[model samples]
Target: MNLTLASGAPRPSQTFRTVFPVLALCWLAVFFDGMDVNIYGAVMPHMLDDSGLGLTPASAGTIGSWTTFGMLIGALTAGNLTDWLGRRLMLVASVTLFSVGSAVCAVAGGVALFGFGRFVSGLGLGGLMPLCLAMVMEFAPPRRAALTTGLLMTSYHFGGMAATGLGLTLAQAAGWRWVFWAGVLPAVIAVPLLLKLLPESPGVLLARGEREKADAV
Candidate 1:
């Protein structure tokens, strides 16, 4: 069955009507991805101040590097996996992995645990960026692809702003743990919505030879 346009027209021009919702969803997910990615930096000062973490300046820097390293691995592996797994599943998995990492940070007893949590989260975090970009790019109309790419990138800044806002407001009142807990909120909110609403990438379906399914979009 063919998808109807929002105006109830039978899929007309393969223009904004087909693309806007997909872009919006990817934009929001990328926004949260940005927020989650930056939350560590935003809370670093508080983490250092806690004293309980026993994080020296040198070690702190090393931990940051480790998290980045984790992200690098995650990105590479997830990119390859996306071809086999499909975009929607990878996005959901990425969100879930990071959310669990946030929770792990919330209850972490030491720097090691916190760093490990960040690393685990990084794996999911790294995968999300390219996946979202690719999905949006593939689905966006030819003339609009570049514009959509820019739009998706903008969500990173928006997510960073949100993380900064949370750090300023919640970290002061409730403690850094609360900030991490807040990070988990995206998993709760975004994961279900993504699984339920985000459409499968048509390219992915077409590659799997599910032409009927792809055209149904």
Candidate 2:
């Protein structure tokens, strides 16, 4: 069956199921990206108070700049790498990079190490958004592509709010390190599902001359 309406647009129900694996996984990844990005801000007050770390206002700003610099580098490089590597692998790698970065932050004892962790996480955070955007757009129903993109973008805000909630609750309770530990959840939770369920991009496959594989997807 065509599984579409008279206008030749796929029904929302059908379209959703067809793309759900990719869309859902991408949404989850982007959500983590947002959370990781904002978590620093959320935990800043607590971090400043921790005298052992020696975090000053000037140094904090410098670390923030390092993160943004890393993000800029990551964003610029990801597109080139994606062309050679494909979206699925790149997305997985990006998630792993950020999660590992979070772990580093969780264990960091000083300003230098913490700043490095943020920079590392920033690389993955920068790379992830474009990849997720590309994946969802590729899989979304034609007529509803804009809506799907909008929906995917909203997850970032939700993730940010979640970070704030965690800052208020978790950071206040267990400590800021534990909150960053929570940032590692995406690697543990989403990675296995993404590897098993997410399909490779058909367009990328075709571009790489895997026409049969592309067709199968």
Candidate 3:
């Protein structure tokens, strides 16, 4: 069956063909977002056990707070940036930032460095959800928007599960640093696909008054 937009203009079949690919890309990005978000908790015990890092309860709490603070800053800024950067590019940058942050943590020699790494990761994490939801809304069928959203959210839990499995299997044998190293994998896997395949949201282009570009999208 053909799906029609409320606008009753373009044929929905053509639209949905584009929509599904975009949805898949967004879902994968969000999946990594979830994985990175929960990976810290999954590996926290091991982090505390590592003597070189010096993770006391007070300092751990402080490190976690720095992550949250960075998130607050990122979240506040990302929406504004979206107008200029476009959602797809912004998502790419967010992923790259967090992946680099995780790499920093993986190699960090001191508390201050690790804390800064987590803060950087948090900033990237904060921007991801809002950008993803907005893009998903733009791509999903009107009647199925809420249902599609619910479906998209399940990827996050699946991501958390993958992080847990990685922690269980790899943390003790390879070390906590390996887990953070694993965090870097998302950039390797996701960024290339995003840049090569995922089309920018037409809504964003139209909003910027680039009607020709919007139609091309």
The model with the greatest lDDT is: 2
lDDT of 3 by residue, 50-76 (tens): 999999888988988898898899899
Q: What is the TM-score of each candidate against the true structure?
A: 0.91, 0.93, 0.93
Which segments of model 3 are wrong by more than 4 Å? 1-12
Model 1, CA-based lDDT: 0.85
Lowest summed lDDT across 10 adjacent residues in model 2 is found at: 1-10
**True-vs-predicted CA distance for residue 177, candidate 2, Å:** 0.7
RMSD of 2: 2.5
State the lDDT at 132 in candidate 3.
82
Candidate 3 global lDDT: 0.88
Q: What's the ranking of the predictions by lDDT, best on top?
A: 2, 3, 1
Global lDDT scores for all candidate models = 0.85, 0.89, 0.88
For model 1, how does the per-residue alpha-carbon lDDT over 18-125 read when each residue is reduced to its tens digit?
777778888888888899889988887888899887877888888778778878988999977878989999999998888898899899989889889889888888
